[model samples]
Target: MKDENIKTAARLLLGTGLIFAGISHLTFARKDFKAQVPDWVPLKIDDTVVYSGIAEITLGGALVLAPKKYKATTGKIAAAFFTAIFPGNISQYVNKRSAFGLDTDGKRFARLFFQPVLVYWALKSTGNVK
Candidate 1:
């Protein structure tokens, strides 16, 4: 397959994952998500989760439906979004908060490695990266 086809497939997959995760954030998994919120965040944990949920939904939809002409810009925004959320992941690790089966120090530490992958995925999947 061609590179563009791969990118399109990746973009769709990332968008779907985000949509599912966003829904979970607002619904069944909300309480669990709160565990990931950093103590340093100024807002209430619940509020932070809700706002991030909304952001995920919006960004995911954009990734799925954005015109080809705007893919790069959308990808840039998505990458930035991923960067913005790195703190929560770090908090989850640093605070040793257990959620989503990341109960052990090794698991939590390993999970930290995935953030940059997500950021790269967002950029590469939308043609923002060469």
Candidate 2:
């Protein structure tokens, strides 16, 4: 496969993940997903999680289904989408909650630390950053 095709496939995978996660959050596991939100947050926790989930799924669908002609924009949207949800990852660690049965203190930072790399990947592939 060409480099562009490979990048497109990876972008699709990112979108796929968001779609699956959003579906889970909007469907059967919203409360569990919200459990990670810190009490200090001002908004209604349930509303926040559910809304975020919906947004994620919508953006994910856009990314995955986006035509090859729109890969650049779609990738940027996916990258920004991922960046936005990152705080939830932090909330999970702070609340001592597991996201998908893999939640643990040691594992928390391990995953959280990759925010930069994810961001970079998103930027480089999507042309958001040099």
Candidate 3:
């Protein structure tokens, strides 16, 4: 596929993934998501999860529906959001808390590597990187 086509495809996929994840956060995965919240976080765990879910839904929808002129801004926001949540992922790993079947230390450790890729995806897919 051509470069723009590839980016469009990636952006669409990322948006869909986030939307689904946001839905999961509000519904079936509420408890699982709670496990991902860092213990040191002062906010109520469930409330934090809900707020993140809402943010995910809003950001995902923006990625899919925002006009071309706003793509870069949306992408930057998405990237920042990804960066913001990364500490939760680290908490999960460091605390040895398992959810979504990332039970093993290796699996949790490996998952940490994917966060940066997600950040890059948000940037690249919206043409913020190129």
TM-score of each: 0.97, 0.79, 0.97
Number of the predicted model whose lDDT against the real structure is largest: 3
lDDT of 3 at 118: 100
Who is ahead in lDDT, 1 or 3? 3
Comparing 2 with 3 on TM-score, the higher-scoring candidate is 3
Pick by lDDT: 1 or 2, better one: 1
Which regions of candidate 1 deviate over 4 angstroms? Answer: none
Identify the runs in model 2 with alpha carbons over 4 angstroms from their true place: 124-130
- lDDT, candidate 2, residue 13? 74
Q: What is every candidate's alpha-carbon RMSD to the true fold?
A: 0.9, 2.5, 1.0
Deviation in Å, model 1, residue 5 alpha carbon:
0.8
Question: What is the total number of backbone clashes in candidate 1?
Answer: 0
Clashing pairs in 3: none
- Pairs in steric clash, model 2: none
Backbone N/Cα/C clashes per model: 0, 0, 0
Ranked by TM-score, the better of candidates 1 and 2 is 1
